[model samples]
Target: MEQTQGMADETRHPMTGNRLDAEAEASGPGFETHDYDVVVIGAGGAGLRAAIAAHDAGARVAIVCKSLLGKAHTVMAEGGAAAAMGNLWPDDNWKVHFRDTMRGGKMLNNWRMAQVHAQEAPDRVLELEEWGALFDRTPDGLISQRDFGGHRYARLAHVGDRTGLEMIRTLQQRAVALGIDVFMEFTVTELCKADDRIVGAVGYWRETGRFVVFNAPSVVLATGGIGRSFQVTSNSWEYTGDGHALAMRAGASLINMEFVQFHPTGMVWPMSVRGLLVTESVRGDGGILKNSDGERFMFNYIPDFFKAETADSVEEADGWYEDKKNNRRPPELLPRDEVARAINSEVKAGRGTEHGGVYLDIASRRDPEFIRRRLPSMYHQFKELAGVDITQEAMEIGPTCHYVMGGVEVDPDTQQSSVDGLYAAGEVSGGMHGSNRLGGNSLSDLLVFGRRAGECAAENAAKHSNERAAVPDSTATAAADAALAPFAEEGGENPYTIQKDLQDVMHRLVGIIRKREELVTSLTELEELKARAEHLSVEGNRQYNPGWHLAIDLANMLIVSECVATAALEREESRGGHTREDFPMASDEWAQINLVLTYDGESVGLARQPLPVMPDDLKELFD
Candidate 1:
C-alpha cells in the first residue's frame, strides 16, 4: 500500500479550486476551497484513523496536516498500544484494564470512556494487523505483550521500540489505499462556523504563501497536545495548541486542563538532546533507577497509595522483576505521576547525576543482547545524539513535559463537542484520561475514540445533508487579514521572543509543582504576553516562513497556557498531574469535580461540574 504518485506529489490539490466556482457568485475573489462531509485536521494516528472510518462510513473525507504523510508526531511513541488481549496473563480482560485505568487516573477519569476504551482497544489493535501491520508476536503466535506503568498486567502490543512508526505507516498506507484526499503540509489556523455550527476550516500551505479552505458540515480536530507551551517538552513544533485554541474561539469548553503529565524518564544529558523522550520501555522491561551513590532509590519513594502492590526493598524490587506472581511490582514502575515526583524529589535533594538527573541503569539489570533487541531505538538515540553507549553505562534521565490530560471537552459516546458539528478526539480531546494517563493507553485511546469521532461526525453531517451550513465569506477574509498582521508591522516584538518568554513563564510558574503565588504571577504575566502577542512581527512573507507560522501559533499557546494556569489555580488539591506543593494531599471533595473552561468572545469563563457516574457493572469491577 505504497503512496501513489497522486498522493506523493507534495503541493497540488485540483479539488481546491472547485470551490472557486461555488463561491464566485457569493463573493468577489474566491479563495481556494474544497467541500467534504468531514474535514480532519492534524494527520496523526487519530486523524488517519478518523479519516479511514469516515470513508468507510460512506462520507466524502479529507485529511489535512502540518507535516508530510507518515511524519506525524505520533511516530515518537516508542512503547506499544495498550489492549487487554491476555497474551501473557490469562486472567486479564477489559474489566481489569478499565479498573486499572481508573485507579491510575486517581478516580478522576471519565468512567464510561475508560470502559469503552478498554473494551474496544483489543479489536482496534487487531484491526491494524488486519490492515497489514507487522507486530512483534508472542511465543504462541499472538501479538506480544509487555509491561508498562499502571497496567495490572503485561498488556501492550508492540513492535520493538518502534510501535508508533509501524502503526502510522500501516494507517497511512490504509488511508492512501482507500484514496482519502490528503492535503499534506497544510496548517489549519481557523475553524469557521455558520451561526453556532461548524461549517469549514481555513488554513495556509506551509510550502507556499496561499490560503485554502475546507468547507464542510463537520470538522474533526485530531490535532495533538500543547506540550510546546513548556520550555522542556517532547512534543514537536506542530503541537502548539492549534486545535485547543480553535475550539475555544469557536465556543467549546475544555475539561481538566490543569492536569499536565510530566514523563519521568526523558534524556537529560548533552543539553542538545535534553527533554527528548527516553521511553519508559527502558524501565518496563527490567531497567532500574539509581542515585549518584549507586543506590536503588525508587524503593524508598513508594507512596502509601501504591504501597500494597509495590516492593519496598531492593531485594524485593529486584526479585519482583523475575518473579512477578510471588512478589510486588518495583517502585520504578509506579504510575507516571508518582515516579516523576519521586525523580524530582531525588534530584532536588542532591542525589541526582551531574546533569541534574537520576540514573536509569539497564546495563547491570538486563542482558546486553536483550537490551539491544528490545531497546534498539534507545541504544541508537543516546549513541547518536549524546555520544553515550546505553548498553554499557547508565543514562541521565529526569522528568520532562510530555502529555496533557486536558483538551476539547466532548461527549464520551460521540466525541462531539458542545458546539454542534465540531468533533474532537485523541490528545486534542479531553476527559478520557482525567488527571493522569498511563503510558501505553494513549495509543489505544486514539484508535477507539478516533473511530468513534469519525462515525459520529459523519452521522452529524448526514443529518444536514439537505441543507448544508454556510460560513460567511467575510469570516475567512478577516482571519486571513489577522494572520497577515504580523507581516504588516515593520518593527515590533519578535514572535520568537514572545514564544520564548511564554515558554519560560509556563515551565517555571505553571510547571509540575505549582503554588498559588506562582499561578497568580503566571496569570498576570500571561496577560502581558497576550498584549505583546498583538504586536507579533515576523520578518518574512508567508512562503516557507517559519516565523509567520509561529506568530499564528503563539496566539494559540497563549490562550492554552492561560487555561492551564487558571484551572491549576482553581483546583486547590494535589492529585494526579496537578500537584500543588502548598496543598499537598488528594482531597475527596475534589474527586467528583472537574474544572471546565470556555471563552465567550470577551473573556474566559471557568466552572466546576460533577463527574459522570460509573455504571453498576463497571463499579463492581472496581470493587
Candidate 2:
C-alpha cells in the first residue's frame, strides 16, 4: 500500500497539518494521516446523523466505519422508530410517550433524557421524512403509526417493518450531499489522548492492514452494543463492545453494565440461524404467543406492577386489539423483560415446542395479506432461512441476546462524556434507556442524541481551533505494534478458539437469568480468558485476514464481559434485564442505585452512584 498524507485545507492550520504528517511518518513506514475538526466512529444511523449535524454547524467532519457505508447494523432493524406523533390517535403526545418509556424501564431512566427523547423524537422523525424518506401512510395521507410493546397508543412511525433501512438511507444521503469525508472498512483500535483529553484515534484499514491516524480535537463514539459477547445474539459481528471498551480505556466511565435486554422474539428453529430476530411487529399487528399445550401462557406471567393496565382473560385481551379505547392492553404486549421471562419459565416447565420455543401465531389470527404487508422481512426471513411459511404457520420463537442498556456515561444535555473531548450517542451512551429499552425506542434515541453530540462536539472543536492536539509518536507506535503482535507469536492459541470459549462462558453463566454462584464463576473464567487473549496467534499476514480481526476484537469482548458479570453479581434485585434468581424480587434499595464501572490502565473498578430523581412536575405524569 502507498503512503497517504494529511490534506491541507483552509479549515486546517498550516503548522498543525505539517506536524500531523511528520508524526505519522515517525510512527511507522507508510502510515496514513487525516486531519478533521471532528471524527465520528461507526457509520450507523447515529454516526451519520452526528456527521451531518457537525458539518451543518460549520465544522469539517469525517466518518470512519468498520463496514461499508450503508451496511451498518442499523439496516437490520425490522421495527419502526418510536415517536409520539399523534397521527393515528389525537390523545397521544410526548407526555404519554414519556410516561410509557419511564414505566417500561421500571423508573430507572434518567428523567431529563427520557423527557428530551420523547419531546424531540417526533421532530426527528419528521426531519427524516423531509430528507426524502417515504414512510407508510394512513388514509388521510399522514405518516402511519403502529403499536409496539409498552407504548400507550399507535406510536411507531414505520416503513413496513423496514424502518431502519429507510432511516439509514435518509441519513447517509444527507451526509453525502453535504460532502463529509468518509473512511470505510477501517477499525479503530485505540483512542489517543493528550493531557487527559481526546486528541485523535489510531486504527488500521481492514482491506490492506495499513495504519491510519485521524488527528481531531473531538471524537464521537456511536458504536452500537455488546451483544456479540454472548453465544446466541441478534447482533452482527461488529457489535463487539468496541465503543464501551474504548471509552473505558480512555478514562471514561460506563453505567448500568448489567442490564442486557434479551428480546423475546427471535427465530428458535434452524440451528444455523437460531438467534436471527423475529420483529415484535408480528405481535404489535395482532399475533399471539402459545405454549405446546395451546395455552396463552403470557396471561399467567403478568406481574402485579402491570396488572392495572393489562387484560386478564383471552376474551378481553382479544377484544383490546380492536377496541383499545374501551379495553386494556393484551398481556402479549407487555414489556420485553416480562415477556422474555415468561417464555423462559414455560420452556423450563416442559411446555415449550420441539425446538425449545413457544409459537408466535399470526396465521390463525389475521388475514394472509395483512401478515405479508405488515411484516414482509419476517415473512421472507422464515421462508428462506428456516423453511417456515409464517403466513400459513405459527413461527417458533424464543428469547435471544439483543440490546445492552448500559454504556459510556455522558451528560444528558450535551452528550459529552466524563472525558473533555469525548462524546457518545445512540446505544453506546448510557442512562437513556435505564434498565430495559422499549420496542422502537432505539432508532429515535439515535436521532435525538446523535444530533446533540455532533453539535456539542463541533462547538468544542471550534473553541480549540488554534490549539489542535497532536498525536504523540510513542502513542501511535504502540498502537501499531499491538496490531502486529498476533502474527509475531509462534505456536500460540488460535484467536477463534478463545472467542468461542468466551462466548460460551458469557451465555451460560451471565445470560438472561442469573445466580450469585454462576456470576462469580463467570468473573473467574473471564480473567482466564483475558490472559489467553493476550497470547492469541493468527496464521496469515494482515491483508484481509479475518483471524487477525477477531484477535483484535477479543480484547474488547473480554473487557465488556467482565463489566457485565461483575455488575450482575453486585445488583441483588430483579428489575428489567438484570434478573437475579437468588434475589427474585425488585428491591427498593437497588432501584435507587446505578452501578458504574471505570478502568485504570491495569484493571476495571466498580462503584455505585445515586439514580437521578425525577422532579415533581415530571413525576406527576405517571400519576
Candidate 3:
C-alpha cells in the first residue's frame, strides 16, 4: 500500500454544498462537474487495482461506482484466486499455469496477456498478503492453497470460500486509506469524447437525481462482467454491461462478446437463490457430482477431450490427486466447459433432481471437518440461504451465467483500446478470457492488466494534462440528455417487461447452447427491444428511480446482448463457451481469427480479424 503525492491531501466534494441549487434545479439540475487526471469507472477488483496503480504512478485518481465501496459483486466470488502457489503441487510453475489458461480458453486468449497473468499472479497474491489479507494459512503459517477446476495443481490460495470478499476488502481499505475519492451510487451513463479521443464521462447520482460529469484525460472502464442480461446469473445487479456499452457507443470496438462462461454449479432450487454460486472449490476438495441414480457421472463424459488426464476408475482418480507425480486421473480437475456440458447432459437424460438440477454431494466423499476447513463459506451459504446442511444432504446445483469473456478490444501489452486515450481492464476488457474464462483466472487478470492499464493511462494523462483540456461538451450533453430522456417520455413500454423479454430471448436462444436460427431470432428480438427502449417511459422524478435508470441500462444490455448473439452466430463452431449446435465442431479457420464487433444504432455489424500472433520465440515459450 504505497502512497504517492497524488494521493496526499486529496479534497472531497461536500455532497450537500455542491448539490442541485434552485437555478440548476430549474433546468433539471445541471450536471455537477469535476476533473481528475484519471477516472476509474468501477469499484470492483479491477477498478480498485487500476486506481491503486494510477495513484502509485503519481496521478490524481477517483473511483465512481454504482454500489457501496466494499459491496461490489466481487464480494460474492467464493472461488479462490489462481496463482501457482505450489502449496499442494511443488512442481507447478508459471509455465504450467499459462498452459492451463490457454487450453482452458481453447487457445483464444491473447498469448501475451495470458503469459503476463501466469507470471505475475503469484506476486500479486503475495502483495495482498502483505496488505493484511488473512488468507487461510497452512500448518507452517503460510497462505494455504486449494485446488480448483481447470488448474492442474492446487493453485487457488483462498480464505476458505470468501476469497473475493477478502480481496475486495483488502483493496478497498488500501484505497480509502490512501484517500482515493470514491463516489458511491453514481452510475456513469456515457463516456465523453472529443473528436475520437476520450475526455471524460457523465453520470447521475443514484441517491439524488443529480447529473455529474468527470472531465479526465484518461478513463478506465473496469465495470466488471455482463451477467444481468440473463434471467439467472451468478453476478450482482451492477453487472449490467454499462462499461461495455459506454465504450462501444463512444466508438471503441468490443471483442469476444459472444463468449460467456456459465459456471457449472449454481443452486437451482427454490428459484429465489436460483443463480447463487456454489464454488468450484468444493469439487476441488473432493466433492462429486451424482445423478438421481447416485452414480459419479463425470467418468462417462471424460473422453478424448480429457482422456490423457481423466481417471479411468474411482480409486485411480482419488489416488492421482494424492500423488500428482505418479498418478494420472485428476477427476475434479477437468475443464469447466466439459464439466458444465456433462451436468447438462445428465439433467437432459432425466437424471435431474426435482428442480432440474443434479446433486453435488460432498457428505459421503470427505470428512465433515475437512469440508468445513476448506469450504466453510459453501456450507454457510447453503445453510443460511437455502437452509440445507451440506454435511447431511446433497446440494441441488445447475449452471448459471458467471462471466462475459467479451469486452472492449485492447492491445495485448498496453491494455489500450482501439480508441486512443481510452483504456479498459478486468472483465470489461476482452482478449484475455477468449471463449471461456477459467474459474480463478479473473482475479489475476484484474490485477495483472489493471495495473498495466493504469500505468499506461497515467503516463498518457501526464503527457496531456499540461495541454488545454478539451472536455466534449456536445458528447457530455448528448449523454446527459439520453440518460434523462426516460423520465420525460409518456406511457409507452414497461422497463421491467422489456428487460424480462430480453432476458428470456437471451436465455432461450443465445444461452448455453446456440444455433444459427436461434441466434438470428435473438438478434431480431433484441432489435425490437431497442426500438421499445428508444421510446420507453417512466413515471417518476429522477431521485432513486430504478425504473428510469434501468430503462437506460437496458439499452446497454440489449446492445451487448446483440453483440454476443451476432458474434456467436458468426463464429460457426464450438470452442470453449461459444457452442453452436448448427456447427458442432471446432474449426481451424475460426481458430485462425477473432470476431470483431462494431455497432450502429439500428444494428450491430461484425467483422473478422486475425489474432495478433506472438513472436516466434514467444510461441516456443507458450509451448
Q: Which segments of candidate 1 are over 4 A away from where they belong?
A: 1-30, 309-327
Candidate 2, residues 1-623, lDDT tens digits: the string is 23464335213223212122323323443567778999999999899999989999999999999988899999888789999999999999999999889888888888899999999999999999999999999999999999999898889999998999999999999998998988888899999999989999999877667688789999999999999989989998899999999999999999999999999999888999998899999999988899999988887876766655335333544534322233467778889999999999999999999999999999998988998888999989999999998889999999999999999999999999999999999999999888999999999999999999999999999998999977887788899898889888888989889989999999999998999999999999999988888788898666678999999999899999999999999999999998999999999998899999998865789999999988999988867
Q: How does candidate 3 score on lDDT? A: 0.83
User: Candidate 2, after superposition: displacement of residue 410 in Å?
Assistant: 0.3
Pick by lDDT: 1 or 2, better one: 2
lDDT, candidate 1, 370-401, per-residue tens: 99999999999999999988889999999999
All candidates' TM-scores? 0.94, 0.95, 0.94
Model 2 scores what on Cα lDDT? 0.89
lDDT of all the models against the reference? 0.87, 0.89, 0.83
| Candidate 1 pairs with clashing backbones | none
Instruction: Give the candidates in order of lDDT, highest first.
Output: 2, 1, 3
**Pairs in steric clash, model 3:** 256-406
Q: Please, what are the lDDT tens digits per residue for candidate 3 over residues 316-386? A: 44533322333354555577877888888899899999999899988987888888877888888899888
